[model samples]
Target: MTALDSFAPAWQIAEAVKSGTVRAEDVTRDALDRIKSLNPKVNAFTDVTAERALTEARRVDAERDAGKKLGPLAGAPIAAKNLFDIAGVTTRAGSKINRDLPAAAEDAELLKRLHAAGAVLLGALNMGEYAYDFTGENAHDGACRNPHDTTRMAGGSSSGSGSAVAAGLAPLTLGSDTNGSIRVPSSFCGVFGLKPTYGRLTRHGTFPFCDSLDHLGPLARSVRDLALSYDVMQGPDPRDHACADRPADPTFETLTDGVAGIKIARLGGFFSTDGMPEAASAVQSVAKALDTTGTVEVEGVEAGRAAAFIITNCESARLHLPNLKTRPDDFDPDTRDRFLAGALLPASWYIRALQVRHWYRENFAKLFQDVDVLLAPATPFPAPLIGQRTIEIRGEEILTRPNIGLFTQPISAIGLPVCTVPVFNSGMPIAVQVISAPWREDLCLRVAAHLESEGIVAAQPPSHL
Candidate 1:
């Protein structure tokens, strides 16, 4: 059997498998081989389900042989961040303490959906401990290195999801974004990532981080793959109370709907890319490509970001309070310290933060009334060197971990849909955030697809890898 190119996008592989040009089992073996060889360099995966992957691939082949139609993601190999449950594999959530727990009884709802679409599960990918950090450094699982530059960070807490797709170990990967986990890594690792409106996708069977702000989405090398994976996973799940009970508004078919009628604008104020040269250039490139000259601002972002921080810290801290009391030493020191701070915050502060969140969301709604889509830098800067704690932005040194989400947090706080498109203006890839109103994921993805069509942005294959 001829092996498929490891770097092929998920859509192409699916087409080849469905057309009988290649066997799904052969593609699965090739994918497993790539993971075995490349995962060590990037530290992207925590587990590799070879037996299960082969079994799934075989099923796909059997269905094809029986003349049964396969789903859109047929024969594609993919992985999920470790925070999502995988049957017989412990959902480590990048924490040593979680290792004490038994393996999950079944896969996460999203994972099951992907499987039903004929995407094979390669395994669980690495991530920041308990999905708390933004730097992608995990004391327990080691750092998920950037595929573009092994010495640099991959961004987190969906570090492995980004790295795996960039390295071509998997064509598609699932990642959860609470603050900026999905967008940050997508920017640093040079891939297309979607953070659907909060509650757009079901989060059942996945470990919780910040319940109010957490979102699950897909990271892929191509916009169509992102759309296809996202389309299949859309629905209502009663198990995840946060999931919206609306009918699925699929974006795959509408991707070619250009930005002609959309009211696109560049973001100013807090979304400005003043300090970071790479980010500034990336945003400028995307704006110019879209012919967008209008600059708009969503007020109250500073307060919104602050509120998101407080909510994330408090909710996550509450979830792990029992573990912190019993096995504090098992927690990552960085994550533990943040959780400790959250534990000490007054209940009144949490209440106030909630109030601020409600106010900020309304502000976003009002801003979106004038614009169909907005553009901003995905990360303040590109990937930092691994273990680098502080970054100098505009002559002032700031903590790298927290500031990475400077632009992403405010949008996440409101649960608006966003699609991050990679722009290669520097050695390390930066990205532009194509944001739309809540439940308007189609608008954001359509804009991203337009950028891709114009060749203004792309997921460039990592040459260093």
Candidate 2:
């Protein structure tokens, strides 16, 4: 294995730094080298803050020697989705309209926590323009390619975060999930992603695509690393009204307890019907490994997904109306027309969608009363070929790539805590969404650990790097 493959987790890296076996400067230097060599091919990063990373590493190393308390993630390297503000950096939510926007005055709150935890910010990663789409095809900043297969798409708007982690550009990356941004990319790129429950983390300083439904989250290679980041980033931020005062999540440190006796179900109906067969097989392996029985039915998914669309399009239109109206030419042509159209959705639809969201949440709540977790396909198909639209599912033809998350958006619309686990399949990567009740990320990770122990987790690249 290469130096990168044998790379330690963030926590272990901190311990190594503390023990003097590995210097923070050395690790940061190696990380910068890796990004330089790998990121160009992937277009995973918009900028590379090498000078700053090295300076920060030297500072942390000095503080450690002076007996300063090192936070849990100290000296660990991380990448932030471009939407998060880093001092003097433009907070572009991946749009040209914001190209002329001035740099932020302060670090985004989430970035602040990560900095406080001692994580070195490598640079800002690329993403879907204004986070308005899911396919990861950016007109201005080239497409973010899937590392597993360069020609296939890396699901977005967290496109850069997914590609960066998959390509070993960074160990942990922050991504926003207004809908399926975080989970989709994690699934497609064969990484672990968590979309925390609504208000679980601060959105302050993170550019919001939609004021009501936006979410910021982490994407990492391992479940433990992802969970560790989540634990540190969560807490009440009076600055964000949606921010919650909830207690901490059970650290993934305890995930080894396993999912034995954990009641789980494979969602049928909307989840099972009309999607890629490989996707079903991937989830089936996890079910069989966990001794889960046949799929359970989930009704009203179409209605739920429709409601989610209404809410997303309406809110997004309002957020960008000024840009869409004055600088229409500035938007990515791929999503510009859709943005213009969204400007016309009636307020009645948006409000009714919220009502539908409430009803769906209640239904999900009742379903959880019987099952510990619900399992559903993360995408209708494996990451589709770059720019390829039509997909064959079972037998019927469908617009495979963009609508792959038809099922995911609804879950996010209600702000459910979700963890997308990569399923080891032979073709392009596939995964299953394991969703737990609100604020129950612990349950989601425990279930993921069970699948991991059974060898049903992401299929690692052969040791060829």
Candidate 3:
């Protein structure tokens, strides 16, 4: 196999393995070797399940040899955020406090689905503490550095998901987005990430952040990989009350349907403000490539963002209240203070936030009447320096962490499906969010695939990879 094959998209790798052009064992070992060599530099993985991966790969090879049909993602190497429950590993969720919990008795529902589909699990990856971060800097596991430039952040709380995929250590990884975790990291690290509508995927055996707005999705080098993984993981789970009971909405079959007649519009107003030139350029590039000249304004976006923050703070704070009341020192200072403050918020404020969320969701849903997809910047900028505390956006200095999700929070607050397409500029990568109405991940993926095919957006391996 050529060196380039190691960095190929997961779908390509799977086809090779299924056709017997490459042994699943060899592919898994090569991926594990890459992780060993490159992970130290990016600090993407907190744990490496090399033995388990090789064992799974061997099973795939044996299955093929026995003339049994393999799954669509057969033999693909993938990983998950540390928040996922691996059978025998502690689900750290990027926190020191959770290290003492007993290992999960069974794998997370998504992991089990991937395994059944023939994907090998490389291991659990590093993440922001308790999913409350956007900078991808974890106090316990060290920051997940961007593969494109190790000096910059990978974007968090799905930091390792972005880094691993961009660095080619693994072709696919799963991440959870509470506000903008998946999209921010994908933008900063240069990869395709999908945040499906809230509750579209099962959350059983995964750590929680904000129950109301939390979502689980895939991050990969290609939109096809995202679609494949998403297709394999979709199903109704009684264990997760929030999981939708609707029929599976398979996206891979329709991913290449082109956006020819799809009505696409750029998000104006708040989305166009407080962002760097690169951010706007990324969105404009996608708009121009798709021949979309229409711009739509969703009013009350700022208020929606505010409501999202209030809801996230209150929900996350409540979830961690027991630990905050005891063993507070174990929590990361950045996370601890936020939780403490949230714990003190008035109940009436949370109620008001919920009301605002409903109002905003209603208004945002109405825009789909004339638009199939909405384009917006994924992050305010590509990525700040690893430890940089402040960023200048349009001449206004702002704290880097919370403001990084400026454009993303408003949309995710309403639980819309969004696909982030990486648009490269001067060797660095920023991304544009192709968003659609609730449960329309196919629309988002369709738009992203068209941009990718047109060469307007794509994932490029970092120099070292």
Each prediction's total of clashing residue pairs, residues at least 3 apart in sequence or on different chains, is 0, 0, 0
lDDT of 3 by residue, 354-453 (tens): 9999998888888999898999999988889989999998898889998999888998898999999998875679999999988899999999998888
Which residue pairs show collisions in model 1? Answer: none
TM-score of each: 0.99, 0.95, 0.98
Name the lDDT value of residue 436 in candidate 2. 88
lDDT for each residue of candidate 1 in 169-201, tens digit (9 for 90 to 100): 999999999999999999999999999998899
The TM-score obtained by model 3 is: 0.98
List candidate 2 segments past 4 Å from native: 1-7, 273-275, 462-465
* Candidates' C-alpha lDDT: 0.93, 0.81, 0.92
Q: Which stretches of candidate 3 lie over 4 Å from their true place?
A: 1-4, 273-275
Angstrom error at residue 247, model 1:
2.0
The TM-score between candidate 2 and the true structure equals 0.95
**In model 2, which residue pairs have backbone atoms overlapping below 3 Å?**
none
lDDT of 2 at 197: 90
